[model samples]
Target: MAALTCRQVGNDFFKEGRWREAIDKYTDAINLDPNDHLSYTNRATTYSKMKNYTAAIRDCKKSIEIEPKHIKAYYRLANSLKMLHCYDESLVTFNTFLGFEPNNNLAQNERTQVKTAIFKEKLQGAQVHPALRILSWANCDNDPLSCKARLLAATLEFNKGNEDGKNRNVKGLIEITEGIMLDERCFIIPSSINLAVNTAFEQNKALSPTLSVRATILKYKQRLAQDGWDSVLPALATNIRAAFLIGYMSRFTPDVRNIDQGIENIRRAIELASFATEIAPVATDDINSIDPILKITFLRTLKVHLMEAILIKYKRNIEMIDLFDKVLQLAKEVIESCNENPISTEDTISYCAYYRGHLEEAYGAIGSAYNERSKFSRGELGFQERDLKLLLESVKNYEKANEYFPSDDPKFALFHYLTASYKLMIGGCTLHEIKQHAQKAKECEKEAYPVFGNYLGDIFEKSMVFQALEQLKRPNNIASDDKYFLPQACHVSSNSEEEEQRFIREYEARTGGTIAATMDLSQAAARANAEFLRNGISIISSDKQ
Candidate 1:
């Protein structure tokens, strides 16, 4: 009873700020009831005040084991553990205190502080991983599992490349790419230009060449070429590489070797396909009856043929302009045959839109090639990038194209650019879409720029230049300008001196005309939008970046 009274007195003394008296009383109580929790807890706190942390911790643990819900005992254990530099153990003690007194304000705050410390430590550890660990938060509208499964199936489909197999991959590839574009993770992974560059050097025919599968694909290629054909093998080789490289390895800068190999491969694909078109030169054969997969693949290959030819023939690049030309000829046949003979056509409007974009992409590249060759010769631009005059005339050629067809129809989109360019070529392209079309032309160049950058086309380069100008005008330094995307815009000054002065003033207030001055600050809040792609500037944005 006397010892118990002594422990009570020790608590009263400790609460009353009588340290010496509390120490004497707690020692007496500990001697009387050595295993009693309150006696040890009070004594440990007194030892802690005496700077005996090891002794305090040992006693505190004994008290805690004897009386688990003793809040004061836990606080003492935490303090003693911290003093001994066992911070992790101290955090555990705080957590224990929190569990018992869930509403305790001080304990909650301590737990939060400890949790934050642990999270920071883990984050610091992740910094050493090779591939960056990026984090984002989002929710899926539909099924994320379905999306992933579909992408996986697309990957499997892409491994098979006979004309039939290749066509099968398109729908899946489009589906996956479109979904990924809409997905937060996909853009985070990267999209088109990077994808195309990576694909430029890859082999597409088989994932792992099973001897049987290899023999089968080889036989199919041989059959397509009819054995004596020289170009068929080369073209198949090119298509296989294009599909492989473009399908994988996005987000890294591609090597010049990859670009060269890609150009070579694409060229072969077109040449081999061309053999089919040239066989009956008199135009006697209806090319539409060619296998559906072969028709679309060949047309698609031909469309990109200009892009391939430009990258390789460095000096004689001018030949690229004449070598490349378009014919919705195959597409129109497909559309017509589909309408007339429904059972034969699997051609979707998306396919038509794809080819339409294909035509524009080719035209865009051709215009770029001519402008590039002209620029290389150091004189003047020979052709306008967008031509309204030719489009107006081409309208007659498209006479049978639906009479009530909305001008926004894919055909008009092509006509719009061609006409705008034709008018501009003859010094008459007046519509603003001429410039807007030029911008869309830049969008088409999205696939080319990562591989060829501004070197691909003049209008393409100009579009890049305009984007650089806007980037220069952007508010801060966090935004980086990709000189490769719009290399032409790097230093754009019209022969007109007045517009130059105005541009200089605006640029001065923000970037100050030098990389040094601009890089130090983040970009303006307006242009630093999360979605802005630093890969290329689309100067023709319907709204600001």
Candidate 2:
């Protein structure tokens, strides 16, 4: 009775936020009855409130010792450890708690928080070449982090190795096979967190660790050709990244067998990303709910879709009308999304730049698609009117792309060239109109000549299309039938085999090693926001940036 009275007094003191008084009362309760588990737990709560997590942990352990099944003792101990940044221990404790009360949402959320903390810590510590770091994690047991890391690494390696002329030694195929095997392992995590705990505690339980690396890779390939997104862990961000990487990489490869697979993967990424944007938080007042990663993923997904459509056009896998319709639909969706999510003060300057770049790319892709459709429709009877209209629309979209593109960027010269090409392709244009477009093309050529000359000298000098544009600049050389110039103008918009190779070499030279060295800083920022939430602070209110 005396111990109960002391505990009640301590509770009242705790309620009043009197930390010292509460600790004194709880100590009295402990003195009255040393084995009282509730008293120890109450005292631990007081210690935690006082920001003395060490003392709280000690008392929590004592309470659990006195009463093994005391549930609050486990909760208090786990939270105290989390406060101390003892994430691994906290994760184990939370798992033990969930073992007793499996349906407790609070405990489940806390457990996920611990896992996220562990993931973020590991990601920070494992900073190196993204592929190497991811591959290193893949070599570990089949935990969630290891599985996701392997997938990310596989994609990076594949991107690095896709171009045959450069980085052929990156061994992307080996990493991709390993990633698929681990993806099979990821299927095990969603059923029960205990499976993860068991895999962590006992290495032999995991299948990947037991098999030889080559055997494991072959086994996964034989068992499953391609694992669907549904079979993997249901993390939206991870799925988006995986689908984008796999799809984008597969499509760009020269292998003919991979084209269909690549298109399927890209479509899956677009579907997932579109769904994510639809559900994203729209209330500007609640900035904490917004995830910038989702926005980035959506933009990248759109870019991939555009790339795939262009590939289809080049490959002639689909009819011209179908290609035009698909690209126009995508362009409409992208334009709408861009208008709805206009850049605000909350967005970083780099994010705004990235967003604008994608917008430019999107418009440019639309113009290119329209131009291709017009080219294919040119000889068809009763389609001349439609073809001319398509060319006009292509010119308009190219102008919009130029508007979004940064004027000082070297790539702006390419946009100017594309715009001039489409403008000159317009039928029935007068000599004055041809001369105007020719002047703009000449100016862009002169501006880009110095920058691109050394790298692209031979290709530019040999290009007949450039020579035609140079002739168009002189009114005296204007042919009465400008139809002869149309074919040359068309060639200006598309890269020749030699020009494409030179551009790739120039790109590699300009961005050497930087791509491998750079990591996604946006993900780091999101992790910081998540950490703030874990600490019970409003991320928006603590705007340190």
Candidate 3:
């Protein structure tokens, strides 16, 4: 009874963010019931929170010794070890936790992170054969995150003309593309770029070229030859460049919501995709080759980008009906193409359905924005009753997309996250529904990370939950004259230097710009390939030591 009272007090202190008080209370509980694993684990957690990792590790190990199955103890121990730079021990402890809770994606993600840390450390120590290290990660209990690592490693190996490289590279290429189609801003881009560079450099060197790394890197500047058959590598590179451009538009554009540059970039991307398709010349028998997936991603990406641009353009010219119809046509084509494919995966089908849902959602949002234009001085469009009707249509399409994923798929989490966001915007959700969806979205992210790995799209899910929770905090009786949706502001800047400066300031203020600075967003295909090759080899070398 005394131990229980102390533990309860400790939990309350912990919840109140009084770490030192919580630790004292937990220590009192441990003194009262020395064998109680919970008391020890709780104290260990408090220590971890206090950044006393050595003491935390000691307490966690004692708790684990008392109760081998104590999951929380394992977690605290691993986390503390990781903080202490005990990468190998942390890796083992995480594996121990997974032995009992195999399906815990949170644990899986943590473990993958530890593994990556270990890999980077080893690479720094001049450990050669990156493919071998990647294989170890890939074969780790058939975990999806490890499988992705293996695919990337194998692709690099194949680029070096190592045995088993051809088959692994082909398979890795396919999987990486699939990952990009699902979400563009994952770790897939960097891995794929690294692999492509090694392969291209090696191939270039074999053709009357020296094996020297410097000579190989120079090959990245050379243009790809116009082969009669459109090989997968060149086509894949085009798609990657296109995806990067779209991301650049979103991230680098002036915050005044100016999207003219974005629109031009999208047009250029579409032209690149079209040219790649024409040059590839797929035979009837090879229809299943990169053609279907590449075509589908290009069309869907184009539709989404075009719709965003159209929404911006619609503010200036309400008569963008023709352009809107064209985007709608693109959406339909994506859906039809997915259904017609003989080898389409369930994931592909779900993606196509999700794309269609976005089309409907965008249409509804634009209508709502147009209707609420009176709220802003720049909007000349008038609202109609049909605009509300379109919003309802948007909700229904989102629900339909959710159905396409079923419960087992990772993408299902994304649908729930998006649906919750839309529901919040639509203003009809009860507090209970909002809470239910927000929690489910969080759980879904935890579930999906082991499968798809973390993505930039997950930021939207986090924002949706944050916004929805803020809405829930407001009183029900609250009333405001503000419109639910308004057209974006007009940002017309003629001076390129001023526009660039404004964008840098706004973007840094919004996202802190630290991570953005680290990401390589080169527009030139040859340059990206070359840079990766130069850095890839240098990641681990004897001379570095």
Best by lDDT: 2
Predict model 1's lDDT versus the native.
Answer: 0.43
TM-scores of the models, in the given order? 0.28, 0.40, 0.38
Task: Note the residue pairs that clash in candidate 2.
Answer: none
For residues 1-545, write the lDDT of model 2, one tens digit per residue.
Answer: 99999999999989999989989999998998999999999999988887666678889999999999999999999998776556777888998898899999998998998799778766766332223222222111122222233233234323323321133322332233223222211111122222222322232222232344345335433433355322221234444444544554565466656766666656655665555565444536544444433454345534435464454644454354766676667766666666766653245422322345456767877777776666543354423323668767777887788776554333455555555444444433322343354455556545433223322233421232243333222122233332323233223324343543343344345556343133121222223322332333332321111
Tell me the TM-score of model 1.
0.28
Q: What is the lDDT of candidate 3?
A: 0.50
The superposed Cα distance between candidate 1 and the true structure at residue 232, in angstroms, equals: 15
Every candidate's lDDT: 0.43, 0.52, 0.50
Candidate order (TM-score): 2, 3, 1
Decoy 3 TM-score against native: 0.38
Model 3 lDDT tens row, 1-545: 99999999999999999999999999999898999889899988988787666678888989998999898899888888776556778889999988888998998998999899878866755342322223222122122222233233234333333222233343333344333433332332233443543454344322222223233223322333533233444544434343434433453344435465566556555554555555454446433354543454445555555555655565555455665455455455545544554223334332322433343334444433333332222234332222435445555655555553434234456556655544544444333354456567667656544334453254744564443333222122222210110100001111233443454455445556753243211111112222322233222112110
lDDT of 1 by residue, 1-545 (tens): 87899998998998887878998898898788776788888888987886555567777888978887788999888766554434567788887876777788877776666566556645755342211111110111112223222222222222211222234433333333332222212222324333432232232332222223345355645655574434343334334433323422221225545555545444443444454444422432554544322444434533344343443343344344433222223334434434443331134322222333333333344333333443322126332232334333443333323232223233333433343333333332122323455455445445223212232344433433344333433323343543211222213332233443454455556555554234211122113321233323333332322
Query: Which residue segments of model 2 deviate by more than 4 Å?
Result: 1-234, 274-289, 296-320, 344-346, 349-355, 377-386, 427-465, 472-545
Order of models, best lDDT first: 2, 3, 1
| Residue 26 displacement (Å), model 1 | 82
